[model samples]
Target: MEEDFVLMKGNEALAEAAIRAGADGYFGYPITPQSEVMEYLTAAKPWERTGMVVLQAESEVSAINMLYGGAGAGKRVMTSSSSPGISLMQEGISYIAGAELPVVVANVVRGGPGLGTIQPSQSDYFQATKGGGHGDYHLLVLAPSSVQEMADFMPLAFDLAFKYRNPVMILSDGAIGQMMEKVKFQPQRPRMKDEELPGWATTGKTPDRERNIITSLDLDPYRQERFNRKLIEKYQKMKEEEVRFETFQCEDAEYLFVAYGTSSRICQKSVQLAREKGIKAGLFRPITLFPFPEKQVGALADQVKGMLSVEMSAGQMVEDVRLATNGKVPVEHYGRMGGVIPTPDEIVEVLIQKFIGG
Candidate 1:
């Protein structure tokens, strides 16, 4: 099948890809850095073309609940927001996780602690990988570094969300969301047939099957514990089967740079710069931040002298790098906060000052 390639912003590409991937509904509130997601969907009028449902919700809370309702009915539904907005949806996300519903959420992350800035940042690393809500639940987190992956991961996120019966997140930063790049869209697929939905989906009961109900509330402590344990087991299986990362020039490297999302793209250029300066530097980019590719990072720790974790946050993912390395090698973090992005040269300088020269 032929693919359609076009120059598009990451958020717009994601919106288009969802329709092409047969998304049944998109319910979202407009927010900077990611407002284009809903804007594109509304303007393109997917409802007229593919009969997809598009609604501008009153707030982030309402939008996420709408996602839960659509997902409960076994429809491929998604919502997108920036950092503060995503924070508002945490409760709903947790409830969805508890009820074992499938929904795709995209966070076009911006700098934050409280209404920080509209520019790019990766401060939400902890929020996305760790539980942002009240529970032991984990989101299947995919970090996209480019506009292409921003579009590409939409189908993959929905596929994984349904396959594991869990919530999935596309953890993108504002830079990637706003940047223009060439994206190739997959051919459109039809939405799932009504009968093809899982038996657990709340699509009205049939005479031959039990009634389908969706709820996160378990009054009994024992039953809630069991449910939580089941969720843990599922997470373990995901770690075993879904860890994804890309290694660049790692074969003979003495120093490594670990990053994800936009930082990873900058790290790639830093690696090239380091190589020109006669420093054997490689980069490890984690595509799936939740499954984390810990095993791969651990293996590289044995080969490299040290590693530097580059991020737009103060130092979130560096903790994961240290854990993966098991403290066997020195790992340090360098970052710019509140919407400022560190340059490749700045990263290289940190590599020299912290890991190499010192």
Candidate 2:
């Protein structure tokens, strides 16, 4: 198949990918660092080409609920928002997860405790991975480090969502969302017809089949308990089979760097800088943050002397790395919150000071 390539902003790639991936609808409110997604979609006018629906919702809460409705109908749907906006959508996000709907969401993160700065940060790690919404639910989180991944993850996220009957999140940051890169867009796939919708879809009454109901509400405690158990089983299965991560210079390294998304890219550079200084530093980049590369990170703990989990947050993911390592090695966290990005040189210095000097 011929690949179509384009140089575009990461956010634009995301919108283009959704259209090319045959997404049925996108409903979202404008939020900085991620507003380009909706703007690109609106400018492209995908409805004219692929019959996709793009609506600008009044708020993030409304956007997420709109996505839920489209997803329940078995249509590919998605939304994008930045930090505070995502916070508003939490309740609706939980609802979608509870209903076991297949949809994709992109979070282009910014600094936050309240209405924080528009600059980049990875502070949302805890929110994205630790079931940000509510209950015993999880969104399959994908962390993309490049513009290429911004384009590529859209289709993959949709596929995974439908496979597990769950929602998926592309946890991007302002750095990647605004950066421009050359992306090789995948070949287009035709949209699914209403008749071709999956068996579980609530596509309205059909003469030959029983009515399909789509919802997350179960007033009965026992019935809801059963559903919760099913969701737990689904998450376990995903952890066992769908964990995705990347390793660099790990075959023979004494120290390790664990990160994801923008932080991972910076850590990759830090590893190189550390290696130049006669330090054996490897990088572990987790692609799937929820189904975290725990087992793999645990395995590395046995080989490395110490590790540092880098991020743009006040160290959210470092806790996960500590959990993954399980006290086998000394683990430390290094980062700047409020949208400050750390430098590779600074990261290597921290590694040396915290581990070797200490």
Candidate 3:
């Protein structure tokens, strides 16, 4: 039998779901909206009873380094923060990607330029999906629009991170992180083993067989080029295997809505309202930002008259949408910033103006 559903905030659900997924360690600093996740984990006794190692680091820099250490030790580890904290962790994140360690990071994004605001915002879209730190690497970025999705995506993030030997990120926002909604917990799979650790792990073995060295430094240009090629190969595979999206009433729609994370939730309501008004509006919600559902969106563009990219930022995913549509459809943007959110009614008006050419 399935478990009963209960209301939960996105951040709270994330913490609980990660614990259920058998994450062995967590390291993070306090940040608005996302801070509750750390609070929940600290209070839940997941560390004391399950032998999980939960630590509140002094800063985001220290927190991410802690994740690097835990992942290098072959332990399932995670961390959560908002935009500024995430910014601080970029160095560690890049290192994790280069070393091919599996670690999960959650960013309940707020507005940004520098010290933007505590309220909800989708401003981190580009940063999360486009290799925020340095190098030509991509993080598996999952955008959860609802609290329920927050719970559902946690284990998936972990699985993908380990499978790809790369960092994975849950890119939500303050709205989803702070808002309460119902969620049904799924039956979790058996706990994973540290044995899943690749041969690259430093197990401190005898000197006879071979010593494993985990470093991104390849002084030889040819070797460095080879490493880059291998990384690109994995990214190619990810593009094929990991793209995920949710479509609503898109089959015969005249207007398409492109949105993700908290912005997409409002888009859902807007689509419903448009239907009530006899306007053919549909929503294309990208669940994975990096392994973007570009092909699917391109297919939809062939049928739709136009597309609207909605976000809390000025325009980030808008660029990706344009790339996906390939200049086939008239793509427009509607958004708010500095922690303000676009309402369903506002989105409908934009649809009216853009689609109807009003």
Candidate 4:
């Protein structure tokens, strides 16, 4: 455990932490907001110190395929991109999911329907937690609200990816990705030795064992269905065991604000402002957006008069919040889109208008 603290931007911390977490390779193209991830890694020269393989792929599509190759070899691999780039990688992402490959992907999201803006936004929530590509698959989505979490979740993302043998995404945004904060990194871990590769990995097989094959294609329909079922079961297990969230001033509250990533930070301040104005308000921040602390949100629904889902997008996560509440209370969405972040005062005003005004 290294307790030494250092100032670092979110993207830089993420890159450094991946290296420290024993990631064997990173393949990605340059994308705003997250480009620093590769930039920092290249400048840090992890290849010299840890023999980590860092390569700048020609495009997002190429980068994700490179990740597939590295992961197939049983190497800890990762990539980072912004909105448009992530969209370009969707096909490869779907294939990786179908093959049940363990890989870490960081989406430092920006506003986008298509190359919308380079600034931060949470609009990618749907594409992230839901099946972005063509498949009945899910990525373990971790939403980091701070620069510190941007660093901390790197190892955790890789851990979960390998633990479930599936893709894990760190769903951040421009705010967290570019912001600077004090971070204390964990000590570096040694990379997995070639001999330690899983038996299922595509390492050269011995005469005693069968060859390892990694493929998303199964022509047989029944076999493919079985594979899909297995993947669903794994997702259910993740939901049951890995749902994570943070609560602020929820006890005995009459109103609740649900948010994640950068939006949650703004909501926290709004909660304080509401309290000052004699409104009983609390905030629920979903740390794991995929598993999505549904049970907790449902429980909160029983106590609160109304709940508001806040985001830097057009009401994406609000749907999940509604599903969690199950119509138990009046749940509404408030957001600012196109790389615009809502202010705490704005959130407080919305809360008052929707839940408090007669």
- Model 3: what TM-score? 0.96
**Model 2 weakest lDDT span, ten residues long:** 1-10
What does candidate 2's lDDT look like per residue over 1-358, in tens digits?
3345678999999999999999999999998999999999999999999999999998899999999899988999999999999999999989999999999999999999898999999999999999998898999999999999999999999999999999999999999999998899898888888888889888778799999988889999999999999999999999998999999999998999998988888899999999999999999999999999999999999999999999998888899899989999999999988989999999999999999994
lDDT of 3 by residue, 28-83 (tens): 99989799999999998786656777899999999999999888877789999999
Candidate 4: list runs displaced more than 4 Å: 1-3
State each candidate's clash count: 0, 0, 0, 0
Q: Residue 356, candidate 3: how far off, in angstroms?
A: 1.0
Per-residue lDDT of model 1, residues 1-358, tens digit only: 3345689999999999999999999999999999999999999999898899999999999999999999999999999999999999999999999999999999999998999999999999999999889989999999999999998999999999999999999999999999999889888988888888877889787799888889999999999899889999999999999998898999999999999999999999999999999999999999999988999999998999999999999999999999999988999999999999999998999999998685
**Model 1 ranges with Cα > 4 A deviation:** 1-4
